[model samples]
Target: MKILITGGAGFIGSHFAVKMLKEQHEIAIIDNLHPYYSVDRKKQHLEVIKEAGDFQFYQTNLLDRDETINIIKEISPEAIVHLAALPGVAYSILRPLEYIDYDVKATVNVLEGAGMAGVKQVIFASSSSVYGMMKNVPFREEMAAGKPISPYAASKYAAESFCHVYGHLYGMNVKILRFFTVYGPWGRPDMAIANFIKKLKNNEEITIFGQGGSRDYTYVGDIVNGMGLALKNLKQSAIINIGSGRPISMDQLLDELRVYYPDMKIRTEKNRAGDVDRTWADISLARELLDYEPEVDFSKGIAETVAWAEQHEDFL
Candidate 1:
């Protein structure tokens, strides 16, 4: 299959691209290399992916509707994995409009562009953040996600709704995957695990917002595999949760850092706005639909992530 992956230069997208290439699928990537993080880091990702497989890469922003459409038409991919977005819940609270433009508006462009190119299937990347601060233990796809606490979450939910609309109107088979807190090698520096590791290495005071709120920190490998499975068996328009079915707290994540840091320090602060109290996923739908099974254990994942941090000391 010829696949088009948006944000193919970022952490998860890059990994997914490698996975697809390994599966012998032809892929073309679109990425703006947003400076939300170091563009150099994204360039490094592109180099690594290029080493792993051959792919065509277009360095274009998704918000450029005409360009996005043209790129899709040029590639003429049978399927698309829409993974591009400004993705940070806390950051979204600080920059709501920017997030809306990048996350929501840009997603509309991708879906519309795909529709124009007559793409048969779309795998839209949603987030567990759409579940918001639900009191429920395990978030289900059927639950009401009407009250998103953060602009980031709201934007993802809006994108998800647009996916459904496009699917219903255009007969595109859309699979919406609500990703949990994904962490692993080549992880984003802004993420808690990576950020905290950086602070730990620098001997900087690590501030724990709301005591490092817990979440279902799914490993990237499992998420990528689940996405591949979802793409393979997508029969209709569906919203499914992709997670480990296990959630852990922020403090626990801190404690696990002892494997590397052994002597890091942390302080607790008030929770920031738009940050959820906790999140867990009910991935039964994914299990039934995609035969998705999360293989990496949380502690093992932490160890692996810490090892990556050791090698990429600059990221820390």
Candidate 2:
């Protein structure tokens, strides 16, 4: 199957692209190589993808409607994986309009472009943050996501809505996957696990917010696998949570990290606004619908991530 993956140079997208390519799927990628992270890292991801074969790659922003539409028309992909977005909740707080422009508007453009091009299926990247501060222990797809605290979460929820509208209007097959905190090797440096590993390796102080908030740190490999499963079962419009369904507190994570890096140091700080205290996913729907189950546990995933960080210290 011919597949188009947006943001295919970023952390999760890059991993997914490599996995799909290894399965011998014809792949086309679109990424802007934004300054959000090291362009060198993005280039490295592209180099890895090139090893599979000379696949299609376009250095274009999703906001460019003409360019995006033209690319879709040319590729005529059987499936479209929309992973491009302005992702950081805190950053969105500082630049709400930028988040709106890239996360919300750009998503609409993808949906519209896909619809016009008669793309069969779309797998969107949503976030667990959209659940906000839910009293529920494990969040479900049916729960109200209208209480998104940050601009980033709001934009993602809006994009999910747009996907539904496109699905209903144009008979487009859409699958919305609300990803939990994904961490692993080749992870984004800005993410907590990666940043903490980097800081600890350098003997620098790592900040802990809210004295140990919790998250369901899903591994990138597991996520990409779940994405593949979701794509296979893309029969209709649906929203599914992709996670380990296990919650690990920050203190627990730090303790595990200390085991890996005995000299690791951390400083406590107040939790930032728009940040949730905890997040655990009810992945039963994902398992039932997409046959998706997380294969890597937290401890193993963190250890692998730490090993990768140690080997690639120069990149940090």
Candidate 3:
């Protein structure tokens, strides 16, 4: 199948691109290479992707409605995996308006383009942050995501709604996969795991916020597999979660890290605004729909991530 991946230069997007390419799917990528993180790292991801297989690369911003629509019309992919968005929860707190433009508006543009291009399916990459501070354990897709704590989360939720709109109006299959804390090789530098590893290597102190909340840290490989399954099995509009279904506190994560950085410096502080106490994804819906199961163990996933960060110390 021909697939178009937006933000295909970033962490999860890059991994997914390689996965699709390896599966012998025709691929086209659109990424503005936003400096929200290191452009060098994204470029490195692109290099790896190119080595995996041949694909069309377009450095186009999704915020440009006309250009994005034209690009989609030109590619006319059978499906679109929308992954581009402004990330960073705490950073979103500082510049909330940008979330509207980058996340919300950008998603609408993608959906608009997909609908206009007669795309058959759209797989939106949502986030667990949309679950907010819900007291429920193992969040379910049916749960109300109306109360997002961060602008980033709110934008994702809004984007999910627009995806449904396009699905309904355009007669397309839209699958909204809410990813739990994704981490692994080529992980985002701003993420907690990457930050801790980088700080440990730099002999700097790692800061833990609040009671050090837990997260269902899902592996990037598992995430890409889930997306592939969703693309194959989904026949209608649905919302599902792609996660490990395992929650680990910050202490547990640090304990795993201590295996490598036995003397890792640490400090504590109040939880930042828009931070959730814990996130645990109930992936039963995904199993029922796509037979999705997370294969990577948390300890092993962290080990791989640390190894990658160590190898790419300059990038980190």
TM-scores of all predicted structures = 0.97, 0.98, 0.99
lDDT of 2 by residue, 1-316 (tens): 8999999988999889989989989999999998888999989889878887768999999999999998999999999999998889889999999999999999998999999999999999999999988998899988955999999999999989999999887799999999999999888888899999998888899998876689999999999999999888759889999999999998899888989789877788888999989999999999999888899988899989988888888676
Cα lDDT, all candidates: 0.89, 0.91, 0.93
Q: What's the distance in Å from true for residue 266, model 2?
A: 1.4
Q: What TM-score would you give candidate 2 relative to the actual structure?
A: 0.98
Off by over 4 Å in 1: none
Regions of candidate 2 where Cα sits further than 4 Å from its true position: none
- What is the C-alpha lDDT profile of model 3 across 110-228, one tens digit per residue? 99999999999999999999989988787998885499999999999999999989899899999999999899998898999988888998889999998999999999999999999
Worst 10 residues of 3 by lDDT: 136-145
lDDT tens per residue, model 1, 108-225: 8888888889999999999998988888788888884588998999999988888988888788998999999889998888988888878888888788887667799999999999
| Candidate with maximal lDDT | 3
Clashes of each: 2, 0, 0
Candidate 1: Cα lDDT at 181: 87
Cα distance off (Å), candidate 2, residue 258: 0.9
